[model samples]
Target: MSRKLSWGAAVALVAVTASVTVSLTYVYAMKSFNTKVADINERQAMYTKLSEIDQKTRQDYIGSVNEKELNDGICAGYAAGLGNSQAKYLSAEKYKAYLNGSSEKSIGVGIKTVQDKDGNMEVIEVTPGSPAEKSGIKKGDTIVSMDDKEIVRLTYGDALNKLDGAAGSKVKFGILRRQNAAGPSAEAKAALLSITVTRAEYAEQTLTSSMINGNVAYLKISAFTDSNAEQFNNMLAARIKQGASGIVIDLRSNSGGSIRGMAEMLDTLLPAGNTVSYRDKAGKTTVQYTSGPNTVNLPISVMINRNTFGVAEIFAADIKDYKKGLLVGERTAGLGTKDEVKPLSDGSAIILPVADYLTLNGDVFSGKGIGVDIEKELTSEQQALLVRNQLKGDQDPQLQAAVSALIRQGASVEKAPGTENAPVNSNAAATE
Candidate 1:
């Protein structure tokens, strides 16, 4: 009877041990599964949330939605999520326009407009011999309406589209011109003018060069397009043949363009050394050096403003880093990242920031822009006066400052044969 009882107790203990082991195994498996599920949910949060919103909108929205626009918005939102202000997604139409507009020729009214503090479109420049110029649309003119539609409510891109159409198409513009705004309140008045302009194909000249003070060669590069390097080299050669004592490069309001073009431009001036470098996401560095024979050895002064950005900033940084030139005017726009246009599966495309750029001294200008050697800040009143003076072929203070600095560096007024010694005019130089 005692042996039987002992055997029974051992059996009972074995059964309990087996039950506990099974329970532990089940709990371990469930914990692992839960962890994996949590991870998947975290990884797919963006996709899941987007899907939810899309579903709700399709089912509950009152208005009929355009799927194309919705898709474009999604693409743009995805790019905006990258947290870079310069990054953007372009729709099919916008992308096509961007590609065509970058070419040597384009059809448009030939006016460059910028948004003011109140989001109104203000004409900053009218191309020479273009329809906008022929229509008497001057710089500093605020565009009140385009084609009878209020332009204040439209985006800059939309306004640009309105200004750009097929050749022979006519567009009407209502402009607000401020009279004598340079003087005190007693002389200021607003006048409205309506004019019609016909669109036509114009050869886009990105760089304009002229002799300032009959000795200093002034070059205003509105943008660094594909042909800019060739144009720049030609301009430089022309100026050299004419015996220019100094050179002033006006990069103000130059939103910047091709990196290759900028590099080529720098190659002309930079000595045989490191000009600039770029870093990738994998911590790899690619260094670019100046390939000499450096031809441009004259005193160079670069003028910049708050509107100077992108590759233009790179140009300024390198000049400042190598002590090759004097940087005048306000600080740059501080955008130094290089972007690449990536095409999506759809017709849309995105401008993605692929790399970060550094100056010759290995300094990055991301949020902090490059500083100038001679900093000059123009007040609103001074800026208004500058625009007025520039339109009248008068001297611009920034250009004057650049010329003065070059003159101080032993740049004398050595006029080329048959060239008159005249005060430098920024408008005439830009138009040339």
Candidate 2:
């Protein structure tokens, strides 16, 4: 190695050394890059494993699988895992039925039902002049069976579907009627009865208004539908023209419907201000304000109960917040949120709460319902009796209380002497 070299040999030696240096540098760079790539792949190993499992199941599963069902189940399960009861997934058929039920027109027996503690379908109301009413069905009738199908085994949706059918179709129901009387000695005696009702197309009457105590307007809103605002305005204007000095809005058992309709009604009552605001998860707020002049300056009272939910609760809460009225009856069902129904490509749909609702003053009543100014708590039996009385055209104690409260608040309405809390006979009461 120490021997003297010629000029050509020295040049060749230098070239070889340069080539070796370049190779060594390239190897070191590749090693560093591979370490980073390996770390990244390791960090994402779970995702890759999931993809592999999904692919295997699709191609190599032992049993037959419905891709639609599987995908729907995955979606429903994911929504359920969120742990929100307000969230739900509706099948194509169910979604269609829900939309039809919400519309102003429907084809069915025209009765609303609820599940009792024992899972029996209890008729909450029978629409007047409907087949259910014409067939002698009454409120509080427990449906034991429908067309030989046990109602106890059916879910709420199933029961509703069972009751609904095409126009001119007939359905039979086995009902258990309970004897109702207003006395301490009145015992519930159940009697079995069967009736056949024909389904028919009928217009839904969501609102009814009448003059009470000579100059007070009593409006009962079953639900806040799309046409409720216009109906309410017309009724109010007519009652005002007929010399009504106060208004009592009965929202008991009103499982809420349209929020926009509710806002429209509120705009007529509340002064120009923020009526409600929806707060998203990102802490962003979108508000709805009352525009135009508040024409109805008369005293107002709102009736509510545990069944009053959704937009109805918001209406009551806004009335109380603005000091525009007194809230009577029990506390409301606090379901203060807005649900958005998104339809999927496969005719399925998802309903989820998109935002939490708040009053104009920023009061959130999600779980804790809006408390009543005058709490009138009643037992289930008492409520049943109240409904029975109402069906018989008797004055509802809650409504009478509202009227008395309005009169006490200096409303120009006249209260009959000794008629406080007394039942109003059908012959003497004003027709709605």
For each candidate, C-alpha RMSD in Å? Answer: 9.6, 11.3
Give the alpha carbon lDDT tens digit for every residue of 217-318 in model 1. Answer: 878887887667888888877887888888889888787887778888998988777766888788788985464666577999999988898989998888
> How many backbone overlaps does candidate 1 show?
0
Best by TM-score: 1
- Write down the RMSD of candidate 1 (Cα, Å): 9.6
CA lDDT, candidate 2, residue 67: 75
Q: Which regions of candidate 1 are displaced past 4 Å? A: 1-40, 114-124, 131-142, 155-158, 165-170, 175-200, 385-396, 413-427, 430-432
Q: How many clashing pairs in candidate 2?
A: 0
Which residue runs does candidate 2 get wrong by more than 4 Å?
1-74, 114-119, 122-124, 129-142, 155-157, 165-170, 175-200, 387-397, 416-432
Distance from true location, Cα of 206 in model 1, Å:
2.8
